[model samples]
Target: MSLEIAISIVMTLVIAATPILLAGLGELVAEKSGVLNLGVEGMMLVGAVAGFITASLTGFTPAGYAVAALAGLCASLLFGVLALTIGANQVATGLALTIFGTGLSSLAGAGFVGTTITRLPALFPQGLAGHPIFRIVFGYDVIVYLSVALTLAAAWFLNHTRPGLILRCVGESDASAHAIGYPVTVIRYLAVAFGGALAGLAGAYYSLAVTPMWADRITAGRGWIALALVVFSSWRPWRLLLGAYIFGAVMTLELYSKAAGFALLPPEMLAMLPYLATVVALAVIAMRPSRGRLDAPRCLGKTFRAGA
Candidate 1:
């Protein structure tokens, strides 16, 4: 690729990865709290639909994002109630939530599939827009800023703050947390909801800024890929950023290649590149032995109760 092409690719990657990073990091936080929310894909779909509809009508991408996040938070509440409070099977609830989100999104956004959104206001000054380093890294939408800030905050929360320590305690051993008078179920519930909001925001980014339109499966199982990224990152926030950006770059490259006239592969193959890479990467990681899990919370995916 030429310098300009390479730079353009990098820019697309950052934009594409913004949502995944946000969603995955949020999930990292939720799972670290011992709640396995498999409904990220569902939450994202709903967010996409919700964000698209809101922005199309209001012409305010920010407001659309807020609505999307709210929708995601509300959708996640069901998962929280089932998995955390009622102690339902986490995997099953996640799948159900996915179905629920998909159905709801399709129904709600039936009228928005081919729509378009205006470009978001640039973050940096016009002079910075063409700057090599500044434009690619710092010049992003407000939500992009939120994603980075949240990742750092999550890192600090898990390592430095008292609440962070306590949240970790709940994730590591809910019974232990309860023994120390922490509201185990309540904490997990809140974590799940926060996670949902983040995922929603990610989805909204897709509708309002990235793809800027409504399309069924626009997320294309990005939720599952993000889930794998969490595992790929071994639960670390910074690694989540790395994994997300890399994945996003790969995804954008596939599209760019097809658009640039590569005849070697089928157009469908190009579209499949990102997901195929995610699967292969995860499989390789699964086969590894010494990558030692550094950021994994102690009791991720286990159901906890007040008296159990």
Candidate 2:
């Protein structure tokens, strides 16, 4: 490929990776606090529709992202209440959240179907962001840059901060943390909320940036892929970023293949490539020794109660 073509592919790959990176970061934080939320897909859909609706009505793209994050926060709080407060099965509650979110987003977004909105603008001015080569570094929207920043921030927070140490303690031994007078449940609630908000913002990226339109299930199961990404990264923030880009590269192939009219593979097969890669990568990870699994937070998915 020529330089321009390579640049274009790289740009597309970065854009494709941003949502997953955002969602994976959020999930990584949540899991670090010992909560397993499987409803990421649902939270993303809710955020996507909420963001699209807000932007459509108000003609402001940022408002959509804000509302989307709030929507996701609400959905996650519901999960927190059920799983943490009521002592419901974490796995089951997460699945229910997904179903709830999917239905709610579809219902809420029905009227907005086929509607289009202005895509998010680049963060830098045209003078800087418009240059062909420099644009490669400067042409992205705010969220693209935000994803990378969040990755660095997350890594730093988890390793360098005192609160980060506490959060890790809670994940490894909620009972011990509770014994030490830490409010385990409260910490977990915050973690879940954070995950939900990011998942929502990630969803908004789909509606506001990727397609600039609303449709049923606009995320196309990227949320699940994000969840898998958390595992694929061994719960490390930097690894999550790398994994998201790798997956992004895989997803970008479908678009490039279709554009190039590569007839060797059916369009349907091409579409399956990303998900296929996800499954294959996961299988390979599972078949390896327990090192990666060992990296998982010890108390992940366990229901916690103050006196239990």
Looking at candidate 1, the ten consecutive residues that score lowest on lDDT are: 287-296
Compose the digit string of candidate 2's lDDT tens values, residues 1-308: 57787778889999999999999999999999999999999999999999999999999999999999999999999999999999899999999999999999999999999889998889999986887888889999999999999999989999999988899899999999999999999999999999999999999999999999999999989898899889878788998999899888876766776677665567787666656765776777777886455478999999998888
True-structure lDDT of candidate 2:
0.91
The regions of model 1 sitting more than 4 angstroms off are 130-134, 255-295
Clashes of each: 0, 0
The TM-score obtained by model 2 is: 0.93
Cα error, candidate 2, residue 126 (Å): 1.1
Predicted structure with the largest TM-score when compared to the true one: 2
List runs of model 2 lying over 4 Å from the truth.
261-292
Model 1, position 71, has a per-residue lDDT of 90
Per-residue error (Å), model 1, residue 275: 5.9
- How well does candidate 1 score on lDDT at residue 143? 80
lDDT (tens digit, per residue) of candidate 1 on 147-209? 888999899888899998888899988888899899888788788888999999888888788
